[model samples]
Target chain A: MELSARNSLAGTVKAVKLGEVMAEVIIQVGENEIVAVITRSSAERLKLSVGDRVFAVVKATEVMVAK
Target chain B: MELSARNSLAGTVKAVKLGEVMAEVIIQVGENEIVAVITRSSAERLKLSVGDRVFAVVKATEVMVAK
Candidate 1:
């Protein structure tokens, strides 16, 4: 599916940590690892697992810059 | 200042498009340009302009993933 979010880094799932309500997904994008905190329901719906390929999606508005 | 958000990509401000209440900031990070939409007040507070160095900050909770 097409996404409006600008940044979409393709990576493999390195780890998945499920909390009571939130789920932490660690993705290895080249040398950098991106950490994503999503809803547990979303994680369950996605059925994410280790070694699976995924794209970290972030909306442009959610991004902030520090000088 | 240190941030909890993992992704802090260093870049230079390429352009700033201000709207009535929102602002769009385009940052040149390496060969990729990241677009950020922020509040007009925040943009004014930062006094962001062209060629300024900045870091694109995104929180883990705000990040999503797609298979």
Candidate 2:
């Protein structure tokens, strides 16, 4: 599917932890490990595995910084 | 709006560059400035401007890393 976000990083699924309402997915991109939290239903729909390849689409408004 | 992916960052709109089909939005989150490219239509719908508060939503499968 087409996404609006352009920061598509190619990484492998390092780990996944499913919760009742949410799922924590850890992706290893380059030398950096990016973590994402998503709905458990979405995770199940993707059938995410330990070695699955995925893109972390980030679309946010307020990225809080130390001001 | 509620999103399926989590990883919400509270950031400020640092800059916005609109393109024909897409818009580049730079958000300063903590010490890092996360960049997100989204559809111009979406950006316009959100009325994204400098100093706007937003959250970056990321959802991907293959986060490519050096293998």
Candidate 3:
């Protein structure tokens, strides 16, 4: 995924579950885990799997940085 | 949230689960559903719920339009 927001976190694909037309892709970024649900058709094309490198893109305007 | 890619899909919040510091927000966009994870602080401030309108922003470099 091409995100304009500056994201710099990488993780390994921990699991993937195919849904109707989308697939839930889970990745472990450091100590945190995040999920990305993409179309099943896309999953098949990407051939994603566990142990594969993936990214968790996050963009929030209200990123309140607590001091 | 700010995204450079153009995305135009709206949905109603379905569920939310608070994690260590993030909250899993689920939204039903028509027949499809997507998840967005934001800091717990954001969720609380937003006051997200099962009836609020939200947008799902998706940007795939390989957004292949199969003919």
- In candidate 3 chain B, where is summed lDDT lowest over 10 consecutive residues? B1-10
Give the RMSD in angstroms, all C-alphas superposed, for model 2: 7.9
Across all models, the iRMS values in order are: 1.8, 7.8, 9.8
Q: In candidate 1, what are the lDDT values of residues B1-67, reduced to their tens digit?
A: 6667888778899999999999999998766677899999899999999999998888998889898
Task: Write candidate 2's Cα lDDT for A1-67 as tens digits.
Answer: 6664444556688998999998888876555567877778878888887898887555443222221
Q: Is candidate 2 or candidate 3 better by DockQ?
A: 2
| Per-residue alpha-carbon lDDT of candidate 1 for residues A1-67, written as tens digits (9 for 90 to 100) | 6777888778899999999999999998765677999999999999999999998888998899797
Off by over 4 Å in 3: A1-3, A62-67, B1-67
How does model 3 score on DockQ?
A: 0.04
- The residue ranges of model 2 lying beyond 4 angstroms of the native Cα positions read A1-67, B60-67
Candidate 3, CAPRI quality class derived from DockQ: incorrect
Instruction: Supply the DockQ value of model 1.
Output: 0.66
lDDT measured at residue A28 in model 3 versus the true structure, 0 to 100: 95
lDDT of candidate model 3 versus the reference = 0.71
lDDT of 3 at A16: 91
TM-score of each: 0.81, 0.50, 0.44
- Give the C-alpha miss distance for residue B22 in model 1, angstroms: 1.3
Candidate scoring better on lDDT of 1 and 3: 1
TM-score winner? 1
